[model samples]
Target: MVLDTQIKAQLQQYLTMLEGDLVLKISAGEDKTSRDMVELVTELEKMSPRITVEHVQLERTPSFSVNKVGEDSGVVFAGLPLGHEFTSLVLALLQVSGRAPKVDEAVIKRIQAIQEPLHFETFVSLTCHNCPDVVQALNIMAVLNPNITHTMVEGGTFQDEVKAKDIMAVPTVFLNNENFAGGRMEIEDILQKLGSKSDGTEFANVEPFDVLVVGGGPAGASAAIYTARKGIRTGIVAERFGGQVNDTLSIENIIGTKVTEGPKFVASLEGHVADYDIEVMKSQRVAHISRKELVEVELENGAVLKSKAVILSTGARYRQLGVPGEEAFKNKGVAYCPHCDGPIFKGKNVAVVGGGNSGVEAAIDLAGIVNHVTLLQRGNELKADRVLQERLRSLPNVTVLTNALTQEITGTDKVNGLTYVDRVSGQEHHIELEGVFVQIGLLPNTEFLRGTIDVNAHGEIIVDKHGATSMPGVFAAGDCTDTVYKQIVISMGSGATAALGAFDYLIRHTAPTQELVGV
Candidate 1:
């Protein structure tokens, strides 16, 4: 059997939910991957009475398509969908067998409304935690709309195709044989990219909020919940619902929970928020914020929102290398998330930049997958924990260089090498590599409030102990503020403090509004 006994048992339980008969139309060759694919499919067929296998020709060999008994579903997998993609494969089988996908009805309508034929292929690694979201979203679209077709192209099994397409990132999507997008994206994000209207009409005439949280990460979610508990009008606007937490892999620092992943934690947060009456506007960005009769917040979609108080919890994003070719080579040969993109560089030389915990951890992880890892640190010594540093040093394929400053990421179509300077010797050196993973740090997402708010040189909002900013009635919290420590629990605590601070400001400063006075 291609699957372990434990995995096969769990898969058997999920397969029992199949609503109708389905067939696995497989195209195979006399290769190892093909043999593995055949074994996996036949094993699955034996587990479910409703499933059967059919040998057939497909666009890609060592691939298979899950279809209803009579019609094609247009959802294909180009390799073994185990690891992080195993859930995606199971969902595909269930949905293709006439089971409804658990998505919003409005989103289903939008997917079905697309008239243009779109053939999407997403390249992914089995270890990528972020790739399944994009793959599942596109698969849902394929299952919902006959005009849309999607294929999960496993990069490890089809390295030649990945090289031909010059793909260095997981979940890199191509539409109609051309690059469409890269990185993790939800179904709504994909719809927006396809010109689906996300106009602000739905929010234009909405009632003003008592408190408006400007982000939807851990901080924003906490604040919104706190404010809504007070029976006041609460709203949250975010570029994406989960913010930086969505890209996180494993998080072990959360209190009460021994360990949890980022996406899983965000799901529970969303569920908790759903229990309240907060108005959530996701996939939207705040373009400007100003104080008038009320704090007027303008969204990039041309919608204006007014609130008695505003809490800034926009969170932070990955800091770029800022060196030459870094921006141009993004998704080409430069990447940020080692967990998401590491397997794509299997058996190739790569470099990890930075000396902190994230950098050292990335170097240690990549050393197991990539052929070699070169870790560059600008400081005289690594800033990681002694245990982590010892572990990273133990890796035979890892090379550590202290006092090294990156100069450029040299590449033509893809990353060919990187140039760095040895600060102690004032000497420059270049190394040929296939990829560069940057783990420097993060920059606060406070550009939109730069001129209006009191921000430090690093663009972090200045906040007091109560999370109150320089501007009265404006509160800031979480990593976007000048918080000494940036942790999920700390962000949640600050969020509560900010919400209570906003309520206090509303009671003292603003005249007694009906919502506040409970009149």
Candidate 2:
């Protein structure tokens, strides 16, 4: 069911009066005669006097209204709550249960004051691990402000839109008509532009910088370091200090550094950038960015920044299992990175889902450390590279289960087993395992960039050889761009390229009177 502002506020108030555990059930069925739905609600009511249940009918309700189905029911179902929409269901329940997720208060205030309805459409695929966080962040915004509707469209289902919009990745968030593109967003950043109370604020007196980078990932960091060293007044804004690299476990391929951990490498990079004169704003969320005489950036803290050039180094995220028990067992038995947690599952059986290179790699890695490895694939053929497929096939400890789709993860406190359906023979089976690593592949973090930059069919940013986007004064690099290879070293190299390009743009435009011809 679509929740409006009034109903959301009312539910929040209702939750504040109650105490104890709460459960909210959103049913897709319209008929009140469904026994399962009734039983579910009955169970919830029995849990605690504070318990509340909600049902949403897909067939017989308005597009965006909260309807009560039964006595004490919180909301009614109105549409399919799958993909990114499932986040909305969680938020609705959280609000009804009186536990608002921790969010920046200023961000919430800004979002609530919006006079226009803000639509955020994010395109994602089931295989992209990194896409979920972007979708979840938008869903949180929708929960706080009913005027904001967040739509999560599967990349395959919206092929036409993908082609038209030139999307090249998943988890791409589109705001109104502008594009925010990939990476996790800090709540404050979202509120600054959408919730702005100032109506007559003019851009007449705002000073501009030579370069402005939107992300603090490897690419953004590299760009900032290079540009700032070149004496450019570079300003780098990021939701967090490190981008996707912060979540990585190890880094073995970074040139110069023989072997390094993810956190350590990021720390070093941050240190290097700190040594320069660059204006680095950590934990700042960029709400809106526009290019006129200079690129304008509105921050969530109610501050505005201007720059002559912009670089988007926002990276991607990990994919998640939508099956039951997956979320419940996060960090318990379900993990996304093998390198991050493989040691914890030593001598224990583990299952690796997906047949791509990452899945095979994870399975092979786990096979070396774990007792056994179950490599489950939804398709009959292995989609990994030839070398990885060969290595995985050579491993006797790795059991390859082709044409298998994971239906559910079963466990009490941790993952004990997983149920899978065979697509070819229609047979269902369960395998016991201590951990399940989902290595489906990476999704480009580009949801916040809809209608703003030119992305590829895969939702990757479309950049020229010099890392420039379709929009002038804006550039992109690293994994976020539509580059053929996505490696840490390559992303760093691209960052350097983008920084140089941005530097050139600033020199040409900012110093138009100077005959700056040579390198």
> Among these predicted structures, which one has the highest TM-score?
1
lDDT tens digits by residue: candidate 2, 1-519: 234455546545654544345544444334432443354345435534666555554323211222222322223323333333444444544543445666545446666676677778766654344444565566666656657766665555445675576443344567776766543445554454444543223333545667888889889899998887777577788877677776665577888888976756777998898898777666666676677777777765567887878998987777776899888777567878676456556688999999997888889888888899999999888999899999999998889999999999889867899999999889999998888998777888777677777888889999999999998888998888999998888988999999888877776667532233335
RMSD after Cα superposition, model 2: 15.4
Instruction: Count clashing residue pairs per candidate.
Output: 0, 40
The TM-score, computed over Cα atoms with residue i paired to residue i, of candidate 2 is: 0.57
Against the hidden true structure, what lDDT does model 2 obtain? 0.69
User: How does each model score on lDDT?
Assistant: 0.91, 0.69
- Candidate 2 backbone clash number: 40
